[model samples]
Target chain A: MSRSTPLRGVHESLGATLTDFAGWQMPLRYGSESAEHNAVRTAAGLFDLSHMGEIFVVGAQAGEALDRALVGHLSVLAPGRARYTMIVNETGGILDDLIVYRLDEDQYMVVANASNYALVARELADRVRGYDARVTDRSDEYALVAVQGPRSAEILTALTDADLDDLKYYAIVPGVVAGTPALIARTGYTGEDGFELFVLNEHAVPLWNALAEAGKDAGLVPAGLSARDTLRLEAGMPLYGNELSAAITPFDAGLGRVVRFDKPGDFVGKAALERAAENGTRRRLVGLVARGRRVPRHGYPVTREGAVVGEVTSGAPSQSLGRPIAMAYVDEGALEKGSLAVDIRGSQEPVDVVDLPFYRRSK
Target chain B: MSTIPDDLSYTKEHEWVAGIEDGLTVTVGITAYAAEQLGDVVYVEVHSEVGSTVAAGDAVGEVESTKSVSDIFAPVGGEVVEINSAVVDNPSLVNSDPYGEGWLFRVRVEEEPEDLLSAAEYTALTSGES
Candidate 1:
């Protein structure tokens, strides 16, 4: 059976074309993918991200338990702050990339990808069984909505009592939005100024309606997964299944900044990461900007001459750049700072290996 | 809501063929349903050029959108007389006006196939019935 988000009916009512995404029936678009992408780039756009998994860890030893299970320094994270962390298996493969929110000293909320929820829950539960922490899966009980873009704050501030202006990036606050008690976080998948509201399933409809009404004056439209993918591509964020899988380590996937090897605590994959850091990974993720409008799609071979050196993990026409771009895992030898060619549909297109993020927000 | 003109014949894949001023030369483009499924076509790649012989189901072109890449199949076997260079430059024409300006190619049918569906039959094929 397919899963449905709390906002599934709302999406359908808006003429959204729905598709099976990560086992959930989610909207691919409402009208046009470009319009939705531009909405988030220029103004603000709402996203129903309720398909994401939310796991809560409570008990006196939550921090210590997570510290041993994940790779980030979670124990130092103060209340109201969130940190991006990763769970690796015993063999040092990534189990899931997640965000850990320190709700309190003894309570932490771990948000993971929907598809990997059960695996993550099982792994964390078995690991924490010996510790003093209790794991609870609250994914079905809560719904998540993200309001993203330049004018996101303007629209969100009007409906929520949360002092969003004071909330710095990656911070979370318990607040009320449209009269519903919620956790408003200053974070998003799209690399735009945004707020993610976590509310009860029952309050989802009213909260969505309220945001839609309040955001109308600000040009905020309901964006779906199509726009979400392009926006994140422009932002140079990695999707779990596409970019970061169990076969790819954080360092190999260009997420080295999120891994803190200097932290004074032992965590899963710590030793392997240290060794990999010293020896360097054999493959590195790089960005590919195709010369023409021909977008290099996933699974297309990345070739240097006639031989396949790598494969495209994700590719699309960048809504912000107005050109085709992609992320690919190339051999370390192919990571040379120069021009490379991506074999797209039997043709070799010259690509510039310039930088990771093809687009950046103006401060 | 756009009607597939009765004079035009269609394929199950949502391609429509209309006889040009020359009765032998038929212009082809995807139906509205095909355009809707492809979504915001940003690029088009026409591989077959003038004088290239193609089979009925042969892929002669590729249409790419932000989310997917769809193959433009030949509706009738014939030598390509002319490719629509305009649609190659601006594929959004396919989404905007799929029937007229967005026509993909004009082919001179070598052997007219009797298996082409009528406009009504094509409509039912896309609408998920017969």
Candidate 2:
């Protein structure tokens, strides 16, 4: 049986379609996923991200431990700030993309994808063995709720007195929302201004209800995993299983910037990553805009003149572009030289190569 | 619960057939239950040409939604008389009014369908599955 989140009852009350995702029974959508997607772009959308894992690494050398365990230089990150990083194996293949938050001088929170968090926790525990820090999997004790979109700050302002204006992007602050303590972070996967609130499991329902009531006039709707997927795809975010995997390195995914070669330490994947950086990858990740209505799905072959050249990683019908969009890893040379098409169920559908992120919010 | 019209017949694949007793032609479309499961229809295609013969269990077309896609099967063996162009242009019709404006195609009856369920049977099937 799939595990249920703390707000499963609330989701059922709202008539959501529950689907098993990453071993958790989560809401896929409340009503129309398109409406939820639009709500996030225009107004605000609430999300129950409790399925995400939160592993705490706390000690005198927490930052140093993370620096050796992951790709980013976490030792230099200031308190109350988060950085996108990845953990890789000895072969330099990405294990999982993570958000590491420096909560204090000797404490850090590594937020990982639901599917790979268990393995990530084990890896961190083993990787930090020599360091003074200790790893604790606090995923079950926390519930993460996110309010995302243009009016996210406004919705949050009604509940908390924290300086939403002063909170920079990728910053987190401790504050009380709806009489419950929460760690409010200005971070989100959707390409919109948003805040993710981390609270105790007991405080989830009330916090969600308070935000819903306060943001009712601001057109805040509860979004689900379906809308979240499309939102992140439009924002050009890479999912764990689709874009990042143990078989693919960060360099192959065109996300080599996350790998910190300058950091002075023997990280797990340091030698292999340096070699990968020196010898560039054969296939590069690119955005594909479908010329036809058929959506290029995961595992679909990206072909050049009937010859298989690459494979699609993630795809969906883009609401913002009014057409279907996909991300695929194709040969870098074929990208510049020849026409490409996605073999969608035996029929070749033409596609145009575009930059990452099918949609971006105006600043 | 999704609305299942008592006048129409349903297939186990979640398709509804209309005018089965009219003796000439019947309209076919996916049930509302199927549409709700699909969650936002994006693209729809009818593969059975207007003048082509199709077997009862043969796949005729497909409906693509935001989350997934499902094949639209022929409920009964017949000749494809016409396809709904409106649904082809705007696939959202499948979710908005699945039984009415979202009718997929019309078929000239070639035989009496042996496998079909009444409205009550379909409701029971969906309820048990859910």
Candidate 3:
């Protein structure tokens, strides 16, 4: 049986369609996914992201230990700030994409995807063994709730007197909401201004209800994993398994910028990453806008002149773009010179290779 | 529970047939249960051309949703007479009103297929599955 999040009862109460995702029974959507997707773009949407893993690294050498464990230099990241980074194997193969938040001088919290967090926690534990730091998996103790969209700040401010204005993008501030202690972060996967709330499991339901009541006038609807996926895709965010995997390196995904070789330490995959960077990758990730209504899906072969060139990673009917959009890894040369078409079923549907991020919210 | 009109016949594949009892002419569409399962319908394609004979249980068309896609099957052996152009333009009608405005095609039946379920049986089949 798949594990349930702390807010499973709340989802049941709302009659959500529950699906087993990454070993967790999570809500796919409460109602129409298009409405939820549009709500986040127009107003706001609430999310129960408790299924995400939270691993804490603390003690004197926590900073030093992380420098060797991951690609980004967490030690140099200012307190209350978070940076998107990756964990890699010895051959520079990506294990998972992570967001590490530096809470204090000797403390940091690493948020990882649900599918790969267990191994990530184990990797962090083993990598930090030589240092005077301790790695603890606090996933069971915490439940994450996110209020995402243009009206996220007002909805959150309605619940707490916390300084939402002081919080900049990618910054975290400790606050209390509905009498429940929470760490509010000004970050989200959706291409909109939003806040992610980290709170104890005991406070999950009450806090969700409180936010629902407070956000009623502000037009905040409960969103699910389906909307989250489409939102992230529109924002051009790479999911771990889809865009990053052990078989692929960061440079192959056009994410060489995430690796910080200048960080003052010998990190895992440093040498292999340097080699990969210098050699350059063969395939590059690109966005494909469908000329037809047929949506290209995962594992669909991208073709050039009736020959298989690459495969699609993630795809969806983009509500914002009003067309089908997909991410695919194609040969760099073919991407420039070759006229490409995705073999959707048996038909070769022509596509326009565009830049990443099919949608971006105006500030 | 999805509404299965007493006047319609249903397939285990989650399609609904109308006017089967009136004559050989009948309208076919996917049931609301299928539309609900498929989520938002973004693209739809019908295969059988006008005046073409299609065997019962043959794959005739396809409905593509945002997350997944399903094949639309012929309810009874018949010749395709007309297609619904409105649903072809706005596929969201499948979710909005699966039984009426979202009709896939009209078929002039060559022969009535056996073992098509009534409204009661279709409801019984889908109610448990959901």
Best by lDDT: 2
Candidate order, DockQ descending:
1, 2, 3
List, residue by residue over A1-363, the lDDT tens digit for candidate 2: 799889999999999999999999999999999999999999999999999999999999999999999999999999999999999999999999999999999999999999989999999999999899999999999999999999999999989978899999999999999899999999999999999999999999999999999999999999999999999999999998998899999999999999988988789999999999999989999999999999999999999999999999999999999999999999988888869999988899999999998899999
lDDT of 3 by residue, A1-363 (tens): 799999999999998889889999999999899999999999999999999999999999998899999998888889999999999999999999999998998999999999999999999999999899999999989999999999999899878878889999999978999889999899899989999999999999999999999998888999999999999999999988898899899999999998999889799999999999999978999999999999999999999999888999999999999999999999887887868999988999999999988999998
What TM-score does prediction 2 earn? 0.99
Ranking by TM-score: 2, 3, 1
C-alpha lDDT score of every prediction, in listed order: 0.87, 0.95, 0.92
Which tens-of-lDDT digit does each residue in B1-130 have in candidate 1? 4467788888877888988335598999988778888889999877999999998899998888888988889988899999999998888999999999999998998866667898888877776731
Off by over 4 Å in 2: none
Estimate how well candidate 1 is docked, as a DockQ score.
Answer: 0.89
Off by over 4 Å in 1: B1-3, B20-22
Interface RMSD of each: 0.6, 0.4, 0.7
Residue-level lDDT for A223 in candidate 3: 95
